[model samples]
Target chain A: MASPQTKRQKSSKDVPYELIYWPGLPGRGEHIRLALEEAGAEYSDTAFSGDSAVQTVLGYISDTNLGDALNPPVLAPPILKHGELIINQTPNILLYLGQRLGLVGDKADEDAVFKVNELTLSALDGLSNEPHDCHHPIATGSYYEDQMDEAKKKSSDYIKNRLPKFLGYFERVLKGEASKSEWLYGSQLTYADLVLFQCVDGVKHAFPKAVARMGKSGDYENVFKLYRAVQERPNIKAYLASERRQKYGMGIYRHYPELDEE
Target chain B: MASPQTKRQKSSKDVPYELIYWPGLPGRGEHIRLALEEAGAEYSDTAFSGDSAVQTVLGYISDTNLGDALNPPVLAPPILKHGELIINQTPNILLYLGQRLGLVGDKADEDAVFKVNELTLSALDGLSNEPHDCHHPIATGSYYEDQMDEAKKKSSDYIKNRLPKFLGYFERVLKGEASKSEWLYGSQLTYADLVLFQCVDGVKHAFPKAVARMGKSGDYENVFKLYRAVQERPNIKAYLASERRQKYGMGIYRHYPELDEE
Candidate 1:
């Protein structure tokens, strides 16, 4: 394991990356944050800044908030601004950062890049988005309490069917020869590992009982091992303990006792 | 507008792209199909290839049925197999094809590729995924009729909020200086435009009345215009007219007349 000091030294310059997202909840921004931390990249987040930072985040999405002519308008936050480029979409941001931070793989291996992206997208589809939907099964705009009945049904279906399916898929991937035992792809840790770790963490928070049941079932041994491996990485371990690691709240992976089953 | 003959001439090989997706309905697969068709790339779809093809598709994801050691396992279809690389996820497949088919932009313009990818991801997030939830609000495994009450509520929220929010965002993007009065990015047609076209078409089919109202309101003129422009493209027009184009039937964008409002 690389020391935190050595990891920080590998990062170029000081605070080149600017992440504009809503403060408080770990949300989707945590996926990007984990990657940055794992790479020991020097970046600043608006979540730590004051209330006005929220406006700055909203400004990019607003039709009226025109700043740089070259910078394209984004639809939502978890927007990454580096130099003149401003872009959104969590997976897209990760792709860019993975390449820039040399976290993906060798630049020459385009096939490996696409494979890592495939893993990232699948994780987001199953773990992040589907889990979010379990609570807000009807509409994201509406309160989860308002759709409690529907959420209960969704959560049950998720725990029984979807959760195992996603976890099992990753477990298989980790067991594959490509994983090489330590990472999701190849020999080194890629951004996809960080993403999968965050996703698993989010699921654990959202459906503790379901995850615990799965853990006891012993179906996803590789998946749990991969999760532990990501957690124990020196830089990631430091970041997780630090105040910089925001606690999970009313974001993509919200914990509701009713939404979980033992 | 390039003739179908001219467009077909540009393709590298004879149907090297194999799209593995569910048969019958045009779901997320339509997004990938639109790109292949518009580019006049020769591609064969497993949907029409018979029952055994379904097994072949499932073989990639099934742990016991692993055929290729090199090909990474995929969770779901809309999986593309070209040469040795087999990959899934619509946006990821499109990103790969966009670069290979010269549908994105100049190879040197790395920034444009990311920007186009951003647009593609945003469309899938709002138009594709959200619209699918309108019918299966509670559980995706269950039928829409089983959750009719919840579907009605979800559909109403989608019509009132999500539909316009997404269409309007694209409208703004189309009106941006980079669009140049023709496409979503720059003066050329990218896969993002094809995706936007397919999404609008799906919305129109699913929520005719709501789309009619938005069309009559005269807000998303640019969106409507881009939709029309893509439909008029020579190769795409031919593809739309051909028997190869599958109709929307109980898929992502289902037409439940009760869900639409005038």
Candidate 2:
């Protein structure tokens, strides 16, 4: 049952990888933060305090030699430094960290993690797109107010249909996992649970009634419990206590109570 | 001066990796195609010819043994199988393929690949979202006809502004290459080149005028020329010549001349 490249560090494995993300708003950074905290991997959030590193990362993205697959690569956060590997993409980063941290469970556990990760990601994507839609309800190039009328309509559909459906799916998954009752997967606190918790947290912030009727999520009690569980982890507690974690803002989870209407 | 783990075929060289993607419509499959082509490794594209395999794959996504990481992760095509590892997500799949295919360049190259991948993907994201917009127009949740008025406005901006901006960036990168005039990185053809070609092809199908205005793309003439060159490659040519390449009806690119707006 040997997998490829399953080697351990022969050198000093003391230091964790450095994560370079924008210093503000947990927006996307929180996903990585949750995984790292859960892994308790020795890592530092470089530029989590100042704007200098954030600018540098963005700049490097446009400049090839400086290190950008493409400027802004358009999305840069949760950069994973595994020994030497620097991986990006929240799911990709989480998957890597999960495998190494043992947060990724057995075969079935891994599958659940991947499914939930993808599913939650779809919800997140839908949510982010909705935000953008609100701004450019009429067109992506125009100002929000110009498209305010259209935004009202798109935002209305999102509130009424998409939000509840996405949240409800999670509620169901969590409920289905009721037998396990504590984690998204089997027993342990895997990255999938962390990500799902983040999604629910983000959505709850963005849509209260939608998520509320989405139920107490009492059916998937363990999943909700795991959400709280992530916060309790020592490294997470420290990271949360630190200034690194960004609060949700207009970026990802804007508090638009009107959009969450039943 | 060698990078650690630079050696190949170190493990799990037994099972050849299988890439299951649509037969046609470059769409996201191009990302996977480029990664493998760059690696110069031999692989198979399953369900490439028959419709049944693709249907099975779609079904596979819902009922995955890998659970969440299962089939066609997130309604996109192009799935990769490496021994026990099955991955989806264009960027995630490409990253994994690049790692195995030996297409990932040096540290700086790796960083550039990631940034470019992210940026390019966001652009593609814009394209997909906009494509949906063409249908939805005024509101994302409403019927296409319902928002036809808004769809026209949104479509106009996407055509005139977004297309050029995105395509122009590619033009800049192609023209910005330091060495080769035929590829995106080093002296060799990287996955980026392949993706650009497919994107160009997709855009041409979706919006001919904007791409034509993109004109010669002399900036990254290599990237531009490489598009034609890669299309003529033995495998690609052969693939296109066959049935696995898919017809133009479904997926990312569609012929809505009205949306393109001459």
Candidate 3:
């Protein structure tokens, strides 16, 4: 989509959006990339720059880097730079992009916009944030090995309680009246579905045996159904097969055999 | 403040806003309550409903409670009910209330709105959510005593690293050009300032010694300055003194002598 507002532009270009995040690993940036990719919107990914982009991402978050008059300092990536606006925070970026890319409903439909944002926030919290905590229960800066015992406890508790709580919640959302279609929101697919898809995919990757057991139990039928539906979307399918969709590694969602169900 | 939109109204009201959250403690719900109180808008707080309100909050999130077609199922508390809308997620509720209550900015100023929301999210992340995780590092459902060792390590790391990082970040924002006024956003007080104030207050309550040392060291000059400013605001001052402003207890921000600085 062409840049709509003049005030937002520092300069015009073939692509207006630039995503500055850590190199490799889907991490949180995957949520932003999914929204952009599903919309077929061309944008720059700093991850494509390889090693050099690591410092670029760090610079934005560095204590010394005081953001300009308009934008405040970025705490962490994925930071989206569209012209003069340097916005961070995963859900905030998705909210901004959702409005522009039509991932949310029309501009006038404030209900859909906020509702999509609400669901997006919930998925990011319950699925993305909680899963990350399982591997790094004690501290973010510390190594996973240092907190292995706590990680095991966290991972087990997550599988038994938090995981099912979130999955079942989404399952309920899908079966609810608002989701008249196969999607989580109204008839159309929004960024929320894409987010739910990525988080579920990461969870399954992290704990394959447990997720498979839950799948077989027929508890989250619609949640898995939505996940598969998002995967098969024309744009998303192509993007997932492409190099643009990064792999899961030692990132937010990591696989540890001991932490998983045997 | 009157309810502005006709579509939002289920019926006319003396108090248009109803806050449904866990009773007794000033948890996440305090963020929404601060905005309503600052705006001098009338709101119905379920906390005042005594022991009975706990079940009402639980009812909203109950597995069997399938929300109406317009509103989806509420996964957690701090749910805001305004006429036909029942919005959850602290930041999302703040976003909704900010616009209506004029705690953000003028309706046309989308820039301020999103910027404010972005900052609010960051504060909620670094300050509120992270601290909650400190005590419950392993699992939210688990007792603090069960994870006391992990909590100590997390709290120590938080005090040494995360606390300074967040405090310093906000301090820079206050020193930045955008904050010509004392508030985090533009000159006037926004919901962000209220959020920052509440989070900082909670942090202080949780870690008195660490925060006192940081204060005496002359770091976070502007952050604490803004915090004091918010506290002194007429409406805020009244709210803080009143019984409506709940105490910090075993909620998100807790005080444990063992968790504090030695």
Highest-scoring model, TM-score? 3
lDDT of 1 by residue, B57-115 (tens): 67766865322445457878889988667788899999889988888864554578888
Candidate 2 residue-wise lDDT, B1-262, digit = tens: 3223222223444677787776545556766765565455777776455667667567545422223322223334567776655656665566556655655544434344544344445545555556656557544445556776777777787777776666555555555433244555555555555666776677677777766666655544544576788888776777667654555655567666777767
lDDT (10s digit) by residue, model 2, range A159-179: 676665544455445544322
Docking class of 2: incorrect
lDDT of 2: 0.58
- lDDT score for residue B253 of model 3: 98
TM-score of chain A, predicted model 3, versus the true chain A, to 2 decimals: 0.94
For DockQ, candidate 1 versus 3, the one ahead is 3
Deviation in Å, model 1, residue A30 alpha carbon:
0.5
List of clashing residue pairs for candidate 1:
none
Model 2 stretches astray by more than 4 angstroms: A1-24, A40-124, A127-142, A168-181, A185-187, A217-223, A241-243, B1-58, B61-87, B95-123, B126-143, B168-181, B185-187, B190-192, B217-222
Given candidate 1, what's the lDDT at residue B13? 31
Q: Tell me the alpha-carbon RMSD of every candidate.
A: 6.7, 6.8, 3.2
Q: Provide TM-scores for the models.
A: 0.92, 0.72, 0.95
Candidate 3: tens digits of C-alpha lDDT, residues A152-223: 999999999999999999988888887768888777899999999999999999999999999989999999
lDDT of 3 at B221: 87
